[model samples]
Target: MTRDKNKKKPPAVQQEKLNPRELNTEENKHSNHPLLDTASAEIKKYLHDLIEEFKDVLLIQVRQDIKKLIKEMTSPAQENTDGRTEEIRKEREASEEEFKHNLEYMKQIQREYQETQNSIEYWQNALTETKDNLLKLEERFRAYERERKSLLKITRNQKEAILKLEDDKKIHNLRIKNVSEEAGTSKNEIQKIFTEILKQNFPRIAKRNDIQIKEAYRTPATYNQNRSTPRHIIIEIPEIHQKNRILKAARERMQVTYNGKSIKITADLSTQTLKSRREWGEIFQVLKEKNMQPKFIYPSKLSLKINEEIRYFQDKEELWEFVATNPTLQRALKDITEKERKRYQDYSYSGREASVNGADHGMRE
Candidate 1:
């Protein structure tokens, strides 16, 4: 390793210079390659010959391309291919200029088309947004209408229920007929008269001190006028047991006289209910004749035991139809029809005939 490190170096020999002529003398304006002159000269000669061989062919092809471009730009025309050499050259030059002008025109047309397309897109987007909004509004309006209809139905049902409850309260009231109304008589006067009538007719009930009168009033004079008129008064009793006893006794006895007048006691009903019962007058008579004991049940239902099976009627027409089919009902109905006809005739002769035009609805409760 010490011998290697101390090794003396010999003097280096110089490289011989080359003659430029031996390198095949040639040079370009850039003067890049020296030894590559021969290959470059051959490449240049080959390219020159290739160009010379295809010069007319290239020029003809270019001229045809320019003429074709012009033909595409303009309307259909006759071609003048067989022309003088000078005329063809001049036509080609004019064609080139026209092609340049058409290219510029096409570029301008492309820009205008792009602008039109952008405007159309903007309006389309706005119209789509508006359509969506309108659809949403329509949906909301339909929902609101549905909700309104639902609310109206609920409100109508609630009103009917309230009216039914009001009518039900009339069940506790009692009406006294042929109880004369005195002139300038107030509630106290009417009560005194009512108490005396009750005491005379229903003795056992009147003696009970526990039975309290909630209200007492004289009937409206118009209702008890003209057809063997009975002056009426209304009484409200709170005790169900006492009221039932009085009502039951009155129904059984069928007649009560007070102050030399034939007084009758009856249940006080709502106007609608009384009208409904009055319509069943003939039906009630039929039921009575048949010993059916048809009664006004809760909510104004007509109930009776038919062949041991309890049947109910809400409509008079249904009762009439049922009677039409049953022999017993048919016979009973005939009697009532004859009675109505006879009553109608008597009224025709009397000239002061009383006809029920509307329902009598006044009650104490």
Candidate 2:
């Protein structure tokens, strides 16, 4: 079962000619052969062991390969997903190479068939068995493809759901940006600064102490920059109404400043929501350039109000498809389509493998 990569088969054995057509009359001729049944049993055993060995490794490889494929598909950035995508590509290449090697081994069996003429039924069975292995690989590959598509759909939905949940959690949370990123800064200092900003802009609620800060801290992940501080403080309060009140006070005030430095107060959004909003921002600008106005309904709905009726775009594909049909955005959509295709070109699969072995296979690959 072990093959020395550099080792060559014996010339006499390698060149042995085999008449596979003997299979047509094999049952008639081998019916009376004494050794036929024993040889058939041995061949079947060899095939069973070989197939079982390969199947175990193949199933494991397919599991890992499909996981990588799903990860690559779900990632938003093509540049970063290359490593996992390459893992999938290598898996397929390995599968193809193994398939080719197995095919060659099957051919060796065919060539050796003449040696088993006295036991023709056994040789026939060996040929039949080798082909089943090939068909097994083909069948598994098809299953992998089906599973990949199903996982991708499920993952996309899950990502959207996770983002929605995260946004919901932050309903009672607000963020402060462009504040000091100084080390050794305490939460009390941040809380004090925020209270002053709120008390100035929102006297009614600030006087009543309705805007209470349960906890406040500077975000941990920060980059040091000479020109500006990196970290922003996040203030967590108890009630959604208090959070809403703070947001409304900031909006009502034309500008909110702390320690003579301008501070921005905004609703805390999940990374997914921010990314979606960023992408939509560009699309909105594109619409504006076309002399068309698009409405962004809160929580990720893009719509066009035409004749007092709203036409909604649920996702990027729908929005782009609508754009491409519009006379104004057609040119831009063409470029976008080409970019998207190029970005995802690596995800394509041919679903091909080496040819099946044996002269005649009813168990088709």
Candidate topping TM-score: 2
Model 2 lDDT, residue 239, Cα: 88
**Residue-wise C-alpha lDDT for candidate 1, range 231-272, written one tens digit per residue:** 567778887667777878988878887876788887777776
Which parts of model 2 are misplaced by more than 4 Å? 1-155, 182-184, 204-208, 221-228, 248-254, 286-299, 311-314, 324-365
* lDDT assessment of candidate 1: 0.66
Assess each prediction's global lDDT (C-alpha) against the native: 0.66, 0.67
Give the distance in Å from residue 38's predicted Cα in candidate 2 to where it truly belongs. Answer: 99
Per-model TM-score, in order, reads 0.43, 0.43
RMSD (Å) of each candidate, 1 decimal: 25.8, 48.3
Lowest-sum lDDT 10-residue window in model 1: 355-364
Clash tally, candidates in order: 0, 0
* Residue 297 accuracy (lDDT) in model 1: 74
Which runs of model 1 end up more than 4 angstroms from their true locations?
Answer: 1-163, 221-231, 320-365
**What's the C-alpha lDDT at position 92 in model 1?**
91
